[model samples]
Target: MRLAFIGLFFLCTTIYAKQPAVTPHGVETPGVQTLPYVIDGNVKVFHLIAEPVEKVIYNGKINLLEEFVKKNNRYSGPTMKLPVEIQKIDGWGYNGNIPGPTIIVNQGDFVRFHVSNHLPEPTTVHWHGMIVPNDQDGTGGTADPVIMPGKTAVYEFQIVNEPGTYMYHSGFNDTKQALKGLDGFLLVLPKDGVDLASSDFAIMLQDWAIPEGSEQIKYLSMDRNWFTYNGLAAPNFPVLVVDEGERVRIRFGNLGLMSHPIHLHGYSFKITGTEGGPIQESAQWPAATVVIAPGETRDIEFIANNPGLWRLHCHVLHHILNDTSYFAQHQKNGIFPEGGLWTYLYVKPAKDQMTRASE
Candidate 1:
């Protein structure tokens, strides 16, 4: 289907600040908030911190991958960003940045994840896909506790798992953080590697609350229906780039508190896997889109069969628009409009893309 974002929308505010400093040991210590911001140029910002440092590393960025949230804990660094921050479900500091980042890895290769948080509250990062040990699930009761703020947690594991679409996000209080935009796509390519498809596509699903007036963020608490990609809302959402007839595989997931019936336009794909884990030949399903629940993920296979900037979004319309404010209502209805700095896809046709001269 060809989705058009042809509607008017008011603007919202973008909040930027320096992250606060933690205690000597990465536990909660008394100090002023010293945040960071992206001023100009292209910046690769990890939404979470994965490990800890003795003093300060990379402006609070943990360099090593660890499995624990404290220094000299279990796992170490690798490095990362906390995907979510608590804001009143009503408004301000609810969700994280859009399409946080594209975490690309190769099969058999390893990535050490250091998921740390600086918020007042506690949380953890759960690798939605991959063979994460029980200790790394990030649940207080099930695995780990809500990692205390000012702490670095490490989760080191291999991508020995097959190559497929997967996800990652805050596993503690998952619903709130997800709906507020704390999620991302994990692309685990094959070791030998297959061919086809454009460079590579990693798409994520998430929603957020972008308030209109103040510089603070706002997210929903419960009873939410808003939807988006990498935190982008209607019209402003990023356009996926592709070449017609190319074998395109989309790595998709839902970090929202609510489940999403991810629908794609134009063609269908093979339902490869769920939660980034491999889908055995017997378990594989085929469809144009798949249904992904919170903390769940899917890998879809399809041809760029039909090209023309086809729109990819959640089937839920309300979640795509969220009324008129975009950031209003704490995104209880949807996420922030996608325009600002987070436009994911911008496909420019290289062949047969331009309009031919009419007779």
Candidate 2:
């Protein structure tokens, strides 16, 4: 009986080891959605609608003002009153999501986009960091005509560039449209079909200027008070979960006004690629923080060896804090406090480690 049991154990182990690892196809954008596409013979077709969207930046039950006062004992003034409900702000987005949904495709594939405009003004989607025919570049008045309100425009192109991180945003009134959250990521993978990492994540960074008492975002204002990742502020951003010792990749895209120095705690990672494409392995260097400037994209990779919940946030003091202007007002009343572009990386134990521990 003992001999038979030993043989069965070895057979089971062999079968398990032979099973192919399920590879992830596309990158995940936590707190945001991905746009779906349909394959038609030789082309991938995607539809997008430009319209107004109400995004919830802060949905926690805790009142930020009260929490700020508690953390700072110097505040003796009356408590700053705020609504006791979720904070929803209005902005323009693609397909009903702030920052829009990510579009993923393999290199060498033909792509077509059907973009419909529902906004008050005309707009065009310029493919940033992508090399395509000038006529299909989606630059209003130069390469292509803008899509008027209630009208749809078609953009067809081939993925001629190498695998890399790219972006799409409004070409007409670029600054104003992007500031109002009309942008998204476009990830082009290699045709060879090799998975880059075990866990891949995409983060879209944006800054907003919303008046103290209003939910409408000020697209023309130079001052920004709220910073977000995937359209969510700090403490509200979705946590990124991975297994210990797994390879991880994070892609960041910035369409906001200011540059964001994204910092990751507990590990030093290598900057692997950018909007232009992957950097040679020999040229890649280790860094704990990478600065993503306006209209830029960056990709980083690391091994999640340390098993714990680590912080990944922007190093900009005000960018990590919510409603900087509101905090400033409380400071005038002797209450100074902190907290936007932030999330946690939860690395759990590997399956083998967990099994050994249980035994």
TM-scores for candidates 1 onward, in order: 0.59, 0.86
Please, what are the lDDT tens digits per residue for candidate 2 over residues 161-275?
8888899998898877878889999998888767758789999998999987688898888778888888887666767878888889999999989999999999999999998
**Count of backbone clashes, every candidate in sequence:** 46, 3
In lDDT terms, which candidate is top? Answer: 2
lDDT of 1: 0.48
RMSD of 2: 5.0
CA displacement after TM-score superposition, residue 266 of candidate 1 (Å): 2.9
Q: How does residue 68 of candidate 1 score in lDDT?
A: 12
lDDT of each residue in 14-124, candidate 1, tens digit only: 121132221112111011111223322333223355221121101212211121113443234442222222112222121233444556566876556656675556777
